[model samples]
Target: MTSNSLFDNTETAFKLKSDSELERAYFLFKMISKEPLVKIGTAVTKFALNINLPVEGLIRSTVFDHFCGGVNEKDCMSTVDKLFDAGVASVLDFSVEGKEEDEQFDSTAEKVIELTKFAKNKEAMPFSVFKPTGFGRFKIWQKITENQHLTDAEKLEWKRIEDRYDLVSKEAHDSNIRLLIDGEESWMQDAADSLCEKMMEKYNTERPIVFNTLQCYRWDRLEYLKELHQRAKNKGYKLGFKIVRGAYMEKENERAAEKGYKTPICESKKATDDNFNEIMKYIMDNLNDIELFIGTHNESSNYLAMDLMKEKGISRSDDRVWFGQLFGMSDHITFNLGAEGYNVAKYIPFGPVKDVMPYLIRRAEENTSVAGQTSRELTLLKKEKERRKL
Candidate 1:
């Protein structure tokens, strides 16, 4: 291999300096970028794997080392403290799976409430994050959101969802722990966004204690953000939104094409990027109306927002905005921003091994779905290995 320095010409970054860490990212990039459909099938199977495989051990050592906090709450905090020491905050996520049973729903709610209590006094754990599906069933949400009539039990189930969030949000409100709800599949998103807006109305009276995530991959979301911002202004309440380009790109397109509907997703990557940056500017321009979370892995996009902020004379420490990347993928952005005195956090997910497999598989596939060069990580590994040799 040529003597290519991975860190060359790069301003400061918090990436692997050791050969071992570099090697792990290189291999993980391959695993995650496996053909999309095949990877999902494999992920579902592996997610259900009861028999241990060699790959699982590789996982514990590689991407898991980079991404997940741990299998338990306390175990998760090791990274929290580490990032906190480096001036970064952590989001406490239970990483609960989407389940249909009432018991599971109740358990997830209790866990989040307990997590909120634990995070209340912690300076590093700034937000309590969870998926709505983690606390309810997807099919029911689909039905309710589609305006289809529901059975009495189905209606009752929806009520339970409201009640569960009420409990969790009440704790967050009383304890002053910020709550963030993750976005999900396009089919069930109407319910998720509506429920989140309701929570925003309920708890966001005094401040942005609850935030709804907006996935900008969809063409409509830019318009959606404008509407949301207007609603926040009209209601005289602060809006909290975490903006992401989105994760389910392929799935969203395939489903729409299969169903013979106009795809809700942007027609091209450029369109999505265009919308994402536009929404970023709109939010940054109206900082007093909203608290924005820049949740993304794209370096150009991160710098675009930051540059815009600087142009507008927005302080890096302005509590109105935040920067976030998943725990594992882009320490380059997360740690560097932290070092620059920006409010940054990693979305730290923690749960039992079985429950976190889906998240892990997505992490694996995400590394693959992008540009195939994969050369950056490869270069990093080779350099670190070379550095160690010298």
Candidate 2:
């Protein structure tokens, strides 16, 4: 199929969405398309939940139901099955965030382990994911990255975090499931990158079971990738990475400005896009040694990957290369790619309605900030609706 037409099959895209679901998706995108509404809604929702104002039901019915798979892994099975039916797989992401306690970190680690076991033999669920901060305090990671000396107690805390990474990575390796380690803000990312590299050294000796994330919006990431690629080759271990245009551009630049350091982010949107495509091409070139899980919502980037695959004589269903999008958004890319015999997975975030609010809020904010993302969703939903009506 031509790159121009690859993602245009709305019928295939929305075939899995019932009329009601389609309408709800359209309405959600319509709401997300407005910046003022998103800002207001986020504040109001946070306030309501903070004051114990029974809004969970309201949230569970609308944004939560649309954006998340369910409140837990068990609750996500139906969505997993449905996506699998459409030839797309699911990556169960326990999207709870912002915990600092070791107990909470252990709990999150257990949850990831359980999800890995849950995905063990399941064809529908190919991978599991977790954030770095989900298993450790953000400050601790930042301290490590900044080369600040940690207190003796802090040394113990860091050990626990490393243990959690090893525990989860070992479980994923044992279960024969791929684990995606999500990238976070730049300050904490170096430590996380080191830990993930350690995991890759351990679990990826035979193959890529532990995957690190590369936020391609950063100007230095291509260089970092090249350095890592050379290291992996020298070390004789496979490398796996999930590359994205990144989610924290504004916060990244703000912190860099406040701290009087040069921003690591690309100068402009076009620069970030160019960087993303370049990183994808670099990974595509070295696919033999590096497995890639492309986590993107950009049509042009996806089309570029498709074209590159065709040019390289890579099989359409190559196991080393997979495409990913979040569950609620980008159905056109996910489902259409799946229909065309590509390996596609949706990152299905799941947690309690209250706990998942931060992630949901971020999603809404992201939709508003990302130029034309929500509008593209609206366009596709509207086109599918019109076609169905006809």
Candidate 3:
């Protein structure tokens, strides 16, 4: 049996962080713990950026440096090397959001392809990730999800989107790097899911080179997983999934209310947790045809995954399973798992400061809204600080 106190070891967790870095983490989490301060801070930062004020340096030095690896692939190498030194891998995430142009979509797709090539032959980076909306217009995805008729121009636009997906998937397959396609809001997710399924069918013949994100906050994800599994099995293709409780909870709930439709989200936090665990268990049960990437900051869920691996007698360094957390947050969980010799990776988001603000703001808000997340981070940081003193 794995020790229940495994994650309580702050020494292993913070060994890579210097005293100044630890203090900055403590201060950041302390500020994020205050909901009001986060709200005010987010607004002020957005406004300052909107006016093109001189806050990029300030933002980059604080939250940007803390949360992100750096502004580009070249800049992120130092952070990736540090993580690999601690036996953790990095997934370089280009986190620029909300682009609506075809050229921008092409650029984003090219970036993913470039990152895949960059990760080639590098043991430190086994994966690359991109958001669906980053490669196509959101309205096109929503229209396809809603099954509405599209104009010829829209058809051409969507064809380009498919080409982008194919381009990236092929690159990942050839480069031998796993690619994760992130989940988006429910209204547009159906189309994204369809596209990802197509990619998996084409590229996952030998192994899982492409992964689809499953936001388990949605009550239907377990059923979706089962259906997808059946389809993959029938077609004799592998499957890969990265499961998270989800982002965009408030946006999802608000949209359901506005549209007068049943909310897709689970009824409560407990329900979401159960759904996540149930889906995770399903993936664990079928590791032969399906690979698993468990992306979560929840300690209990991490423990459950570890326990399941133990029960199944899977090796600690199995290539078919990986545990992932974001770069700045969840150091305790990531580092502890790494110490135990589990396959661990950190999703290291990087982009220009202005372009990556949406991603960073969402992270801060998520830390504030997820009950006890900020406090847990604070407690661990404090414990590490005290340990250093002793």
Score every model by TM-score. 0.90, 0.99, 0.99
Off by over 4 Å in 1: 1-12, 15-19, 30-48, 51-58, 372-374, 381-390
Q: Give the TM-score of candidate 2.
A: 0.99
lDDT of each: 0.79, 0.94, 0.95
Best by lDDT: 3
Off by over 4 Å in 2: none
Candidate 2 residue lDDT tens string, 1-390: 455876778999999889999999999999999999999999999999999999999999999999999998889998899889999999999999988788999999999999999899999988889999999999999999999999999999999999999999999999999999999999999999999999999899989999999998899999999999999999999999999999998999999999999999999999999999999999999998899999999998999999999999999899999999998899999999999899999999999899899999999998899998998899989999999999
Q: Clashes in model 3: which pairs?
A: none
Q: What TM-score should be assigned to candidate 3?
A: 0.99
Candidate 3's residue-wise lDDT over 1-390, tens digit each? 678898889998988899999999999999999999999999999999999999999999899999999999899999999899999999999999999999999999999999999999999999989999999999999999999999999999999999999999999999999999999999999999999999999999999999999999999999999999999999989999999999999999999999999999999999999999999999999999899999999999999999999999989999999999999998999999998999999999999999999999999999988999999999999998988899
Give candidates' CA RMSD values in order. Answer: 3.9, 0.9, 0.7
Model 3 lDDT-worst window of ten = 1-10
* Local accuracy of candidate 1 as per-residue lDDT tens digits, 1-390: 212232242234444234565566666655554576546655555744656555656556665666688888889877788788888899977875757899999999999999999999998988888888988999988887888899998899999998998898889899898888889888989988888888888889889888888889899997888898789778877888899988888898899999999888988989998999998998898888888999987767888877888889999899888999887666666777887788999998888766787776666666667674245555544554565567
Give the per-residue Cα lDDT of candidate 1 at 378: 53
Clashing pairs in 2: none
Cand. 2 Cα-lDDT = 0.94
